[model samples]
Target chain A: MMEQVRVVLDHAGDISPISSEEYLRIGGYQGLKKALEATETIIDTIKASGLRGRGGAGFPTGLKLSFTANTQADQKYIVCNADEGEPGTHKDRIIMVEIPHRLFEGMAIAAVAVGASQGYIYLRAEYPYVATILEQALADARRQGLIGSNIMGSGVDFDIQLFIGAGSYVCGEETALLDSMEGKRGEPRFKPPFPGVQGLWGRPTIINNVETLSNLPAIMVKGPKWFRSMGTERCPGTKLFTLCGNIAHPGVYEFPVGTTIRTLFEEVGGGCPRGKKLMAVQTGGASGNIIPASLLDTPMDIDACAEAGATFGAGDLMFMDEDSCLLDVLENLTEFFEEESCGKCTPCREGNTQLLRLIREFRNGTAQEGDLNLLLELSNVMRGGCLCGLGQSSPNPILSVLRFYPDLFVENSYRKGDLAYA
Target chain B: MTTREEQLCVLEEVAAIAAKWRDRPDMLIPVLHEVQTIAGNCIPKEVAMTVAREMRIPLAQIYSAATFYSFFSLEKRGKVLIRLCRTAPCHVKGTKETLSAFEQALGIKAGETTPDGLFTLEICECIGACDVSPAALVDDTVYGHLTPDKVRELVASLQETEGSR
Candidate 1:
């Protein structure tokens, strides 16, 4: 019987998200207050907490903050990646709609730690109503002098503005997000002078995801040791997992990292509905791996899932029942990648279209035996040569399905020369 | 097509919106969003030109952003644009049926606008309303937990509001 351990979502539904007074009543800006009091030690405290980015990458949050902090720059900025564009993931929407002040407080703490005087919340255009809610929350925080100049009577001045993205999925990648914020096409940029060193307007900018920033207020108020007390050694603190697809319970659930897939499926999600047998599960969003039901006991931590040849990307668990077809699922995911590829690099731009065509052939039962080898070759090229995460992980669903259920391909395909390649 | 005078009115409105953002090049997307809202859900050629000139941004950059994003439209749309979720969760939960229901109710297929200028049907990647699977966004509002009956009823209600208008 696994249950939700509410850390970031504390007082979620009970508090008025638009009212800073209610947030204060529940100890909202205490973390920002603590952060303002001890500005020099904030980065060290965050490092000790072992908090990682919740936006699928699992990068350490403290290290990212310290990079921008350590860099010498006249103008530093903190950008919150509220562009929650991942398929089957809606936890950030809930967090922003329920506990927006907590998110703002987290950003203020990060700004104080990194010496950034300005911040931006790059909200997605899909969630326009969520933007209105955040606007109200931001207004309330400003009214209390919590976000603007001289927060809590301290000399630290930091304020956040909302910038809405139109409808580009690639903008969820941090570099593309920065490019989009600059009012350009949402295409990713080359790294090495990463956003930590050279970001928005070529200034040192620290971009943290909505979920990652939402954890800061709690960590600062509760101390680093208390934050590290839960979860695994490498992956500390709770994670928000959104379960959907053929499951009885399909909503956001918060649990400590390292919770097994079996517990999330059976005990927490109540497994597939109507006594249907679970055939396969896709952990992470559209780019996540598709594993068979036999591997349900794998822990949902970053290191554990990576060790199991999967990723804990954005913590989205999508289940499929016996009635579902593996090839159809692969087609849907492949089509998504093809549509979302920014076309900046050749591998991602052309590779996704070819992959989609290949998957459709499999779905139509017209795929030849050699098409499997072609599919693998294309996926390898895309994974190895794509510019950003979108193209790199686009082949995950195909590869994972081939790994777990190779019998599906063999059973469904035709002999070579029986069907011509389209 | 709008007359030259009507185009001038739209250009003036766009210039005002661009000025509201201080004509900052970085505020191009926001300015275009407002212009799209005012110009009937799409950025017209004249309006884009006006934005480019007022915002001091290149026309290519404006078009790059407008076409890069799914929300921005180059052609005119209906008064109401229905963006249905076409992602995996919605697909697994029968969004196809809901989509067909919408197409049937509206007498137009996906990506087609009704002749009456009331509704436009299109598919979007995801709007993060998977919990209520089979969701569609009308304007800025999200309507989820949809069946064929719900889809028809929603269309009827929208048509009624338009008829009264």
Candidate 2:
């Protein structure tokens, strides 16, 4: 069946549309106004909506908000996690570029709901233009009385700040993001305190992804039933999939969570770029496993993604067609993890170094018979022992790639040239 | 000692930035970028010390941040700082050719400054001008799609402009 391309864009077909103007026009602040007007309704709405954390873990967003709200602290903070350093994952970048104001409004609304006064968007420095736009939007939001004290005369006060990561991938982990924001190195902190309890200057905080926040307004405005009706029971609402690589049309696709990846590619993204068939689909960016083209009909719903052993992770859907080498993709993603690892824990820091060395060996063809086994073993050690999400998630690519592409291993071995896009 | 006018200039700039973005607190990088573009490449020690006095950000932090990235030039720079790409894509295209051309043109190594201070040459990570294959930045201005002859002429153009100024 043919389907219309869901316009996740701030304003469809408007070239110069600013996210702020377009967002406000599309019943944007109506949610914030509603939240401010009925404080109790905010928590109830999120709980009823069933919106899972799109940042890969799929935790219940309302539950996290409610838990943080219940925590007894002098102050609580809201952080929009935008440190999207994953290779194929440019999804968060789209949200930041198109509707930063919407994210801000969502944060402000969430902040008020949780009795918090301030929010932070920890964006990576790779998004220089997004950073500039966010700064501009923030200033405008402040001037409009949507952010500052007594917003809209509802007496709900809130403000937002942005911090840029030096392109560290691990900072996407909620706790690590909290640490980096506190003026320390961009390494992941231990999580018994959990950002929800002791975050940002040892205060309670709620860290939600940019996409997760964008959904807040919709959930609040249209009600949870409308959101739930789109996706499955556990997974609700239309997700924005940042489609890229050898596909015929490489861009973001906003569709219901349960939409099969094939339908998304065939109908929404206009089928694989050129006539090339799909080789693999990488959901959840670099951390998630790569599904082979044989599984093109695999539904991209949260349950299916989990059964396929990948998380939604900021919803970065990377499609690779035939004629592309998995070894090269692994190498590209590896190089990113190596450079972006914060080096706080031994497993992630040293394990990543060892993994890269081994991956390089496989590419160099200097790999021994047990080289794959050894890589798998190292991944196991890193996955279980790492301090934070950075080290733990590092094994995902190594583990997933070896399982899917055994032929790419034996033929190419290890070679530096394989990493390049030929 | 730095003059009072210099002190007041740093004071007003820091104060203005603090007043504007004190809430955001994350605009510090862009703020510091504009500050360093003033006469010297870095926030001079005196200026750093002054910002420290007003904003409570330490002089050490200011120096540490300025030194962390290659973009923030700490020491006095030559009129032209020729930072060429040294990463994989550029290296694959033979950045050595560019290095050799600069060596012959300036009679100095890639990291050395000419005795006359007209040019300072160095290798850098990718500056995102991969379209140029071998590219360079001269004083924050990008020169893409460069070759050996272009490097030589680029130096010549710089010398000509310096003379005119």
Q: Which candidate is the best by TM-score?
A: 1
Model 1 is docked with a DockQ of 0.86
lDDT of 2 by residue, A103-139 (tens): 8878977898889988888876545567787888788
| DockQ of every predicted complex | 0.86, 0.13
What's the chain B TM-score of candidate 1?
A: 0.94
Which segments of model 1 are wrong by more than 4 Å? A415-422, B1-5, B21-23
Q: Give the deviation of candidate 1 from the true structure as CA RMSD.
A: 1.8
| CA lDDT, candidate 2, residue A143 | 79
Q: Per-residue CA lDDT of candidate 1, range A156-192, in tens?
A: 8899999999998999999999999989999999988
TM-score of each: 0.97, 0.77
Q: lDDT: which candidate is best?
A: 1
> For model 2, how does the per-residue alpha-carbon lDDT over B58-80 read when each residue is reduced to its tens digit?
66765655554345555655657
Best-performing candidate as measured by DockQ? 1
